[model samples]
Target: MTCRLPAALALLILPALPAGAQSLEDSAARLAELLRAGRAVISENQALINDPGLGDKGLTPEAFLSQVTAAFLARTGSPAVSEDLPPFQRALAEAQLEAMGQTIAEAQPLINMEGVGFKGFIPAVFARLANERFGELADGRAAVKITAPPELVRNRKARPDDWERAVIEDRFLSAGWTRGEAYAEETGPGFRMLIPEYYSESCLACHGSPAGETDVTGFPKEGKAAGDLGGAISITLRP
Candidate 1:
């Protein structure tokens, strides 16, 4: 029910929806956007989190949620929790936000630690943790996750399953597929959607060149360039 989402993809996660798309996809996509926004806020404050001179960076759940809202608005040109959302959609969105808030609040001590150059609070890690909380909060009604190609995976828990792997390799990574497009369909389980993410300039610092060389989190770089198929945000809604 929980999985990993890639780091540094705030700018490239959402894709334009097709006309008359299913409401399920819309709701799932919006939840994915919110999760990405949370990651974006965390990425922007990496310096503060790693500041050895600071004891309290002041990124409480409320403060962080405000930043996440602003980030979502700036990126998507829409309010994160729009008033017009259906009751179900709004409920699920709020649950996702609540999950994120709880996750960050619980990490307050670690994030504000002194003399720590890198607390390893990167966007990917935050996304993964938040998603874990989301699964529990959502109570099996929905789930969100980020995962990547097999060779690019660092956490075994983040490994994409057969469904995600097939979509990533046969669709998202296909040269003919449209860039930034999301793929969705209902099959074996529940309704599922995956928004493709590319390696942006920001992602290069950790996921970029000098293949096999260790990056900040001690993972080898994927040597990927900007615009390469880096990962996907996977969403599932129960039937």
Candidate 2:
């Protein structure tokens, strides 16, 4: 739908973290905010495609994602980032770009199915598909994993990693923090990053109670309640 934020909102929302010379916390927060914002934009665009009025106006998911990718690239000014940037920061930006590109590519097939309509699918499905594909690419060089506590996972891929396991057990699941947390710490020669994700009402159909029930895609439900510590998205960067 060619979603464009108001100029004022754009100014406030699109700031990219400086490519170099920032604290780990600042860098992590910036990356988290950027990724979250990108996700929000994609979700909003998907909704527009489902809007009858917008659909009739020729808004398609592919077109909407393409525009979003372009806007994000422009906002990041990534081309200007020096090749000498810290390995973690550079890889972070690269992964973010790869993620957006993969979303646009992976969504094309689904977008083509617009003729049949996306009746059984939710926006998060597309997001997960894209992230999983990116996770494959991240192996060895960097890492991206989405996982919840063991009880909340429907499959092995969603099982918590060591860092996520600790965070969920010590913080969200135990300490009751509803908000996302971000931190970067040394891992071998580089660092690993983590961001928490909480369950919302939209997640109920798939992850909420009645444990053995199947969701729209027929995947087993996790019987989780709203606001539960659904999972975290973890990333690792290496030199």
* Best of the candidates, lDDT: 1
Can you write out model 2's per-residue Cα lDDT over 29-121, one digit (the tens) per residue? 445544554566666665544443322423344455455555555666543123665544545555555565666565554544544543443
Please identify model 2 stretches exceeding 4 Å from their true place.
1-22, 47-91, 119-123, 132-141, 176-179
lDDT of 2: 0.57
Count clashes in each candidate, considering only residues at least 3 apart in sequence or on different chains: 2, 2
TM-score against truth, every candidate: 0.89, 0.65
Off by over 4 Å in 1: 1-21
lDDT of 1: 0.82
Q: Write the per-residue lDDT of candidate 1 for residues 31-66, one digit (tens) a residue.
A: 888988999899899888988899999999999999
Superposed Cα RMSD, model 1? 7.5
Worst 10 residues of 1 by lDDT: 3-12
lDDT of 1 at 81: 71
How many angstroms is residue 92 displaced in model 2 relative to the true structure, after the best TM-score fit? 3.3
